[model samples]
Target: MTWMDEFWRLNAVFLVILLSFSFQGAHCELVVSPVVPTLVKAAAGSTVTLAVSFSGAPDPTVTWFKENLPVVTWTIDSSSPPDIAPNYRQVLRMRKDGSLTFVNVTRNYTSNYTMKMTKSGLGTAVTYFTLLVFDNIQNVELHLQPDPVKEGIDDFTLQYVMSQGDVEQQMWFFNAKEIKTDSRYSVEQNSLVVRRPKRSDTGQYTVKLENPFSTVETDMNVTVLYGPDEPILEARPDRPFYLSGDSLSLFCQAEGLPQPTAVWVFGGENLSHDGVLNLTNVQTSQGGNYTCMVLNGQTKEQRQKNMTLNVYERPSGNPVCSVQSVNRNTGLQYHCLWWGGTPLAWLSFPALSNTSSGAGNFNLTVTTSDNLNRKTITCVAVHPVEQNQCNVTASSPVDFLPAVRTTFDLGEGKIVVTIQCVSEASPEAVVSWSKGSEAVISGSTYQISNNTTQLEIRYYNVSSFLLQKYACTCLNPLGSRRREIQLRGPSISDFRLFPNQARTVVTLTWEVPPASVVTGFDIQMKGPNLPSENHNGSQIRGSSNKYRTIQLKPGSARSADVFNLDPDSTYRFRVVPKARITEGKPSEVQILGPGGGLSGPAIAGIAAGIPCSLLFLLLLGGFIYLCVYCNKNKSSRQTRYPVSRAVEKAITAQPDSTPHNLLTGGLKSPPDYNRLHQTPSDRSVALPTFVPPQPVRVATTV
Candidate 1:
């Protein structure tokens, strides 16, 4: 190893150490405030301060620079020397202190300046600051927002920015109050916003600000812009609507801020220079398209829209009438209107509502026949153009004649019971009587009378059992009306009233049948008791059931007036009522008073007595007389024996033979029997029939 090499290595190491120490004390270390640094703008005539500190040196030489050029330098007796830039002035003092000052500032003097110093040559230090100087300051620009607003817009915003010679340097003021960005007043970049602008926003807005170094704050007045509101369109007199052949007119009108111009349109066509539009006469074609236009003069805007016009025509034409089905008493009616034709009109028919219309509406009405047949109605419409015609038809309801089965009772063992057949047929009805299922209306005991619509059931003795099913049936030729009859039990109301009294009021009552079967009630009552109850009683005739009672011998039983009655001094009472129950034969008397002369306090009667022996003999004699005398006489006179059917046919077969008697089983053949029987009285039913005569054969003994 050489000593020179060692010595040179030591020198290089010492030099490296010295350089490292110097870097560590100055350039390598940092000087910064935990407090943040800020930039301030100063007006041309204003001044501002900056803060600086060092993390490396406590006392060092300081120098100032404007921007990248040096401005001043200071040293503690060469501790920090002073340096300066051109066109700017500054003075530096504060011996051995770090404070520095500037005087007579100018606009260009404001800049970001840096200073550097060394601590006794042990360290080098540097710092950056803003040196702001103002020559003069002006107003800050303020923006009052809410432009292009509706009438009565209340809210607005006042905002400003700071400036030295630029708009960004100004701040805003509202009514002399400074404004900043916030919720109600916000600045989007530079434009200020005022939410919910209303009438209350009308106020003063001024901007005032200066650079951070300036003392003066200047303000500028601001104003907002508003508008003309929406316009409402109107028309003079009325809207353009007319009926055919009528005069029509319309005018455009509008209301808005600032005068508005109005225009009229017909079917979307603009109107002429004159304000009014006049149509001398209107037609159906004029029914469509009308409009109005409104132009706001202040806003310089126009609007137009269409409306509608309706034209109507007077009602036109009348309806037509026709007839439908016809019957004896039934008829039909029909009506049609001249609607839905050219010229578009309406029609009304009052007569139809009153006369024919009652029966005929849109449809036709026909009267029904008594035969229950439906009647047809027809309607015919005749138009002005003879060829134009319409027709319709309808049917009338079928008619139903209501009728019923009824009965009447004549009190007695042999009652005159009637089976009444009734119905509301158009013509008088014909009735036939029957016993059970037997057709007895034409027989000897039953005389069928078409004139009265009844069958007289007589000649045969009436018995209780026989009355059970005796029926009378009535029918019309058209079969529209039909009814049957029935027989029923009896009604016995009163016998004798008070005995020894002068005349008595006989209380009479009877059972009536179904009202539907009978139109009215026929009634009769009688007194006196029969040998058996409900047997033979005082005769009671056809009872026209009305009065409840009839005056009679008040309290006594009469032997003299006792025939179809109870002669037993114990009086009986019987009644026959018209409507309901038919007499099923004459019923035995109902005993109302005591047997043996009337015994009740008010009833009295005289009785005749017969000896037991005489009664036996009289009964025996009477029985024999009836059997022998009546039978014998009947046999001797029995020639054709009640006109038997055989004899009647024999005689009728010979047309040339003259009928001996209608009751003698004699007749002449008639081709049309119905015509021969009872033709109209208007016309003679007596007509002749042609038939060949057959020889009468005598009974031959062989």
Candidate 2:
């Protein structure tokens, strides 16, 4: 190699050794003195300090850690260094000697504290310290003696107590205001007392107990009791007076600390022990002074109330009903009365309020009618418990008689006879009709009215026999009455035949009936052989005759002509008046013939002479010769010669020894044609038969 290279290599080795020596001289070793302990104790709100010394060249960096976390770090700075952060600088401070100081330590600062120191180009140094912080005093409490203080009776006391802590000061407050101890109120170490505590002393009281580290406060409430007010008395009826049989009740009430009880007294006698006193159906004897006493159980105080009750009597009796007077306008007056009732408002009746007098009497006038006759008058006296009553009935009598009337109506070719029977009775009367001796049943020919007061008998083309006597009888529960009325036809009078017209055309003239009640006339003519008879045998009448009816105007009195009659023949005639209901009695008969006054023998002789001219000549001649020769010119001789031919034959044909002379012949065979034409009579062959002539009857009525 070259000289220059070797020389430089030697110089380099020398510089390297010099540089190693210098580095070894500049490096400093770490040394720790005054080691920190594991645990340190401190009081709450007190300061704590931690100190440490460490040696190292190129100054070592120091830092603090708790549970391996960095707490504080200290380092040397050249220029313009940043300020320490607030959290670490507030509670802890770093010194130039690498120690930490904690000011006013609390429980939160009781964890492990670590210190670290740092220098340029050197290793770091750290120290740890554990802290415990405690407070000896705790939360304060205030208690009260006589918790519910009774006002005017209790002295109040407030006691204060606390935990194990050093308390430096204690203060008292009432209602959040500072309280200074005085004569009225005083305080001890843990209690306060008030002398003669009034209701004003009942309020909230507080005690503030504090140590060097903490302050604590507590509150207590006090209450007091007071007195009740005076008692008040009340009554249910609200009135002091009452009538007999009234119900009464009393009440006693009061407001107090404790509820009050009542005692009731009547006229100095204790009656009840509750707050209410009730009396029912009170009498006059029970009326007196009543007192109610109220007492408080706890306060031992009492009150009294007094009242008086008055009872009056009410009148009672049975009501009396009497007939007062008869009123001209209204009728009968009746009055009801009761005497002397207190507060008459309680007594009542339908007519009481309308009375003319105020003496508890009622009057009413009733009319005399069917309603009054059946009515019962009543008087009522109303009372609270029961009602009094009195009643009377009215009496009346029946006062009328039966009346009968008959009416005739002619209409529609018929005649209606209405007979009405009526009577006035309290109860309606029943009426019945009787015709002659027989009862007239209603309906068909007889139609009775609804009330049986009227009966109507109807006839069409009525005849004389229908006229009759009718009796009407009316009956009720009280009595019976009868009335009779005759329904008569027209009266027939002056019945006769004209003498001049008696033989040939007989013109019979008759007077019309007296009344116009008749509508027609019936003419009955009986021949010599025929006869007519009526209902009764009072008049001579003959049956087997000819009848003819002739209508005439009503109310007319005139004559009728009858024609076509036989000559020298005897006839008897009668006329019956016809009405709407029936017929009247026939007129007396009149005989008409050739010689009107001739005897039956003369008539027969004349009739016999009418037949056979030869016998007529013989008889006439014989009669004349006898009259001349025998000197029998008397009326008896004339009568004896007038024998009918049939009688002559019977007399002449008799045996000679039969004792049949002229007188005997006259005695045995007198010739009345009706006697010879009997229903059963014998005739002789020698006598010629002769037929009696029949006449045409033409009857008319006016």
Candidate 3:
């Protein structure tokens, strides 16, 4: 062939190959009409078609399935009719293009339909369709599980029911808003379940049932029975306290489903039935707790709130002001008092610039200056309802008469000393007793009688008693006076020992009464050894631990000096007053060696350390006791045999009268078998006497 002929031939072959590929590509591409599937709906007596179209093969084998079951099969190019299943043979029909048609459609024909196509070269193409047949959405009703739902308690359901048609889709709405399924709400088939409905759930609820052919909606008005919330109580012209004849008005409010009603109660009496409680000309008897109770008629729930009212009265008549002298005529006290009122009246001294207001009773003290004499003071009393004033005049101060009397009485083989103090003053004085610098109260040694005006010293010992002085004082807010009393007797006073720098040589001094009372004084000394020299410069070495006497003549100075004493030894010295016929009690003193005593701080440290040491020891002993007890309990638990529950119950039921055999019986037998089988009259029996075992003692030689 020529070159042009060859080119034409190659072009022809290439064009042919391209044309083959184009034809294969066009035929192999499967296209289904309306790629997204949609539901189909029709009336029961009407005809319907589940339309599905695909272009993959010209003579593909087509099969239709209803809910995964093959209902019909047909070939597009076959001349014979389509094959249909026995159940759908009467109502179902298939076209040559593989579309399903339902003739005289009934409610039973509604189902899911799937169309699948298969050819030799091409694989498979599948499409889905849902069919629903309905007559008409009529006689539709929404029923609730409970006619009246209880909030926060009952689980209620709203079910949609139709007598004529089937529902394809259902939706719920509350108060015009769609209700979404959540923890509190759920949709089950045609029912809407509300778990634990609340008060907020009370409203109009709508359920919409829809199919492709029709949509129907039903609404229900649900009222949730709820509580009458805590009543809101309010009072007009509110105040903490009110005066007599005051008016009061109280109002109560509450919110509930059925419109709660309020009732008023006070002091166990029904005051009112309405929300408003009015009190006109209220008296003190009406002051108390007032309750307002709100109730819901439908829910049968009630709530109450309380309010407190206090009524007071102003003071009657006039205030009284009095003046008295205090502090031993050095100052004057002016007092104002207003009594007989519900609440105490307020009193103030306007003229006294430094005084503040007081309740009921008020007092003002001023020094006894020239300005205070015969001065008139005014006391003002104020109350919520009224006010009053009074005046008092201060007079010249009066002097008080004070007297001290001593009386002697014999009792219990001893002489009792009684000291009495009498003071005549306005606003009576308080009497007190003191020994030296310390105040004394009634104790075993001293007794105070007659409202603290008389003091009795009982069981008197002359040696220690004569060394101290007693004082009685009569005191008031304004002033005080004191009187010193010394017991009359031939007794030594102020007995003291003065030690030298070496603490060996010492000097003794004392006080004594007149020479007529005491004839001569005898100085007695007892120690390890007698002093080598006395106050007269006489040397004497007496026997060890023997009493030595140093005599002093009457009218002599009460002092003595000793020399050459042992510093390591303790010495006791006694001074005795010798009367004309009888010897008086002796005053004694003891001197300790420098190395023989503990200091004050050391003694205090020992005293404080004793309790702490004792506490620690007590805690240690408790811990050991707890450990022993726990171990003993553990051992007992380990060694004890197991007892049946029945036996334990029986033993507990009749613990004191349980027989010994019942305690030791084996677990195979029932507890209290005889008691259970016996009649009431035959239950009583003779109980055997129990004897305690004696303890056995074992003796061993050490």
Which candidate's lDDT is highest? 3
The estimated TM-scores of all candidates read 0.33, 0.23, 0.45
lDDT of 2 by residue, 444-480 (tens): 6888888888887776644532456778887643346
Quote the positional error of residue 682 for candidate 1 in Å. 73
lDDT of 1 by residue, 1-702 (tens): 699999999999999878867887556553433122535445544334444555454445666566777656666456334444444545332334443444434556556766666666456666666755554444445544444433344555455544545333555566767667776676555445666654344466654444444445544444333332333433344643445677766655554444556677775577643445676677767676677666765456566666566665433444553433334424433445555433333222333333432211354444444433222223333322322333332322223322223233344322233334554442333455556777674654455555645554432232332344555554433343334344333322222233332222233333333322221222223333223323463333222222232322211112113233322222333433222234322222333222322343312111122244347546655665565456445544543224434434543553433221111112223232322222233122222232323322111000
After best superposition, candidate 3 residue 162: deviation in angstroms? 4.0
Candidate 3 lDDT over residue span 436-530, tens digit each: 88998898778898678888775434333444567878765445677776555556777877778787778888876421134457777765554
Instruction: Tell me how far candidate 3 lies from the true structure as C-alpha RMSD in angstroms.
Output: 46.0
What's the number of clashes in each of the models? 68, 26, 4
- Cα lDDT listed for each candidate: 0.43, 0.59, 0.70
Which residue runs does candidate 3 get wrong by more than 4 Å? 1-39, 44-46, 51-60, 75-83, 104-112, 119-128, 133-135, 143-205, 224-251, 268-270, 276-281, 299-303, 325-333, 350-357, 362-371, 397-702
Clashing pairs in 3: 326-478, 327-478, 327-479, 328-479
Q: Positional deviation of 168 in candidate 2, in angstroms?
A: 5.1
Using lDDT as the yardstick, the better of models 1 and 2 is 2
- Candidate 2 lDDT (Cα, 0 to 1): 0.59
Decide which is better by TM-score, 1 or 2.
1
Off by over 4 Å in 1: 1-60, 65-70, 79-81, 86-99, 121-129, 134-190, 193-260, 272-286, 295-302, 315-343, 346-702
Clash count for candidate 3 is 4
In model 1, how many backbone clashes occur?
68
